[model samples]
Target: MAGRQGGHHIACTGLSAFPLTPMRDDAVDERAFAAQVARVAASGVDSIGALGSTGVYPYLSRAERARVARVTVEHADGVPVIVGVGSLRTSHVLEHVDDAVEAGAAAVLLPAMSYHPLTDDDVIGLVETVAAHSPAPVIVYDNPGTTHITFTQELYARVARVPGVVSIKIPGVPTEPAAAREHVATIRGAVSEDVTIGVSGDPFATAGLAAGCDAWYSVIAGTVPEVAVRLARPALAGNAAEADAENARLAPLWQLFTEMGGSIRVIAAIAELLGIAEQPCLPLPIRGLDGEQRRRVAAVLETLDHAAEPDRDE
Candidate 1:
């Protein structure tokens, strides 16, 4: 997996996180999305996550997801774009892997599949299946909070050995320093340090850096890519002071997302406030923010210097 076959060493090193693009009226706002990607890339993020949970992969039709993926890669310049290929059906996920390759993504990220409370073998099979089909590389995304299937240390080690399996996206849960250490050990033991370990959690990204994770995958990056980039740079460079200050500024926003439900709502709120798209077009049940919640999110966005425009009627 480490060869130089027209692919660079997968740079999962800095602020690389999944970003949700707010959709509108059964179509993604192409103009707005291009602008959003350009802004995120300019903010110093190391990677862009397309069709992730935030991107509402489950909600979009196959073609729509492909369009988003293609547009994302085109606008990302050289930044690595991790294509989300998490689908319940193995065939569908493989199809997405092909799409990622065609769209020129650097890697694929997939959540642990169907087997709720998946066994080691179950996790291994899923990882192996996706790894076999992915053109670039694949990262096993382990988020028990959403997928309801948890891959233990032994299971992770087994999957890590799969061909083309190059990274692990672990939730920075139980966010204590000790917990982060245990996770890093678990992931590192499963694969060589060559296989990156990406921590995902608002506080966990910062905590994981302290715990020695190679990279971080976070939702916080969607709202404030600059803050996320600043936070990651200091830690990656071994500068604790700057990292801590950056995290301090991000803490309130983290609190806001958690208190206001979680990543989905926070992403929707931010997209609305930024006016990047008309409405947060989450599939049924994941609707736009209510009046009070909108006010709260607006307050948070007001603190940032990023450009904001009035909502347009379409």
Candidate 2:
């Protein structure tokens, strides 16, 4: 769990916002991206993860991804930044790790990217190699949805043995809330206590935290850090009532995300709706919501904003 260069150890707990990388003219829009990062940093998130799936890391070129990481660190304004360094090739992942370390990232989120199904040994090797080379601590990102490589409790235990592998981001268990809780417990039991277990996929966050997850690697936090924090604080403190109440309020937003494919597309539309950025997303096959879709998102945002405002005593 020690950081490189005597830096602070990566604290993989609380809300870590995975902000979108704004794009313009088919390239990263530096100005817009900075603004978004600054906004999230100021919103009281525990950390910022740049170039994640939500950040369209796979879509951007290595140079662009590196630039985004540096920019994220700069705009994080003292908040820890965890840069995603997942790539198809282990060597390419190392290059990303170097970039993140050079940019002073607090940690690197490493996902085993593979076209062919990866064996448990393949995942272990990938993580060991990346952690060996990375100056920053490596967070094994177990996102089966995108990477198609799921990390079992046994695999997590093996990866935790790798030096500098400090945390794991478990993809949220979408169904059977009890199963999600059990899944978190299983991972928690299997891995060393030092290897923090965080949950991704915002809808499952409340249950995940209730189930003993250490942190929430959230897409919703990227757009609405205040809301995410409100929900997380209560949940993490074992206040299930308050946490569930807050989560219930966000059900509509989560429903929208599910209806519109997924968080990547919906979140990009959300950023645009909030004026945090203009059409921040990857190009076609992964485009943002259209005008009509945006209006629906705007409506939900307005409702959420109103509900979040403190009531005035007459």
Alpha carbon lDDT of each predicted model = 0.74, 0.82
- The TM-score between candidate 2 and the true structure equals 0.92
State the weakest 10-residue window (summed lDDT) of model 2: 305-314
Over 4 Å off, model 1: 1-9, 115-117, 305-314
lDDT of 1: 0.74
TM-score leader:
2
User: Distance from true position, residue 196, model 2, in Å?
Assistant: 0.4
> Considering only N, C-alpha and C atoms within 3 Å, which residue pairs clash in candidate 2?
none
Q: Write model 1 residue lDDT over 79-188, tens digit each, in one string.
A: 77888888877788888888877888888888875644566676778788777766678878887767888677777777777878777888765556688677687678
